[model samples]
Target: NLVPLLVPLFVSAFRRADELAMAMEARCYRGGYNRTKMRQAVITTADKVAYLLMILFLAGSIASRFIHILV
Candidate 1:
């Protein structure tokens, strides 16, 4: 039961860390306004599908655990 919760939390934290690192790398401290984004970040369909599947599976696992505990 706790596994489902922890896995998603860890994954989210890791993704956030990656985003922070990328933002730091993209930052220019020289106060220059002539820079363009090297890579435009866009959400892909695959990412959306994966996120949905993760949520669905997590929900199912939690529900099953709760039912088991109740029974």
Candidate 2:
């Protein structure tokens, strides 16, 4: 049956995936050293403003929901 043929092929496919995963993990472990970041990230005034706005929006949503629940 073709099923018998497919069983080995599936087994080979899964085996290859496991091998690739291990190889990738090993390569990443080795590659993490001697890596230089391209840009130094800094948060500025705009980021602070955006964060405050998001917090305000979340609080307003919660307050509105609570008000609705009481009504």
Tens-digit lDDT string for candidate 1 (1-71): 89999999999999999998878778743335666668977999999999999999999999999999999
- Tell me how candidate 2 scores on lDDT: 0.93
Best by TM-score: 2
lDDT of each residue in 21-69, candidate 2, tens digit only? 8998987855668887799889999999999999999999999999999
Q: Candidate 1 — what's its lDDT? A: 0.89
Q: How close is candidate 2 to the true structure, as a TM-score?
A: 0.48
Give the per-residue Cα lDDT of candidate 2 at 38: 93
Best by lDDT: 2
Residue pairs that clash (backbone atoms under 3 angstroms), model 2: none
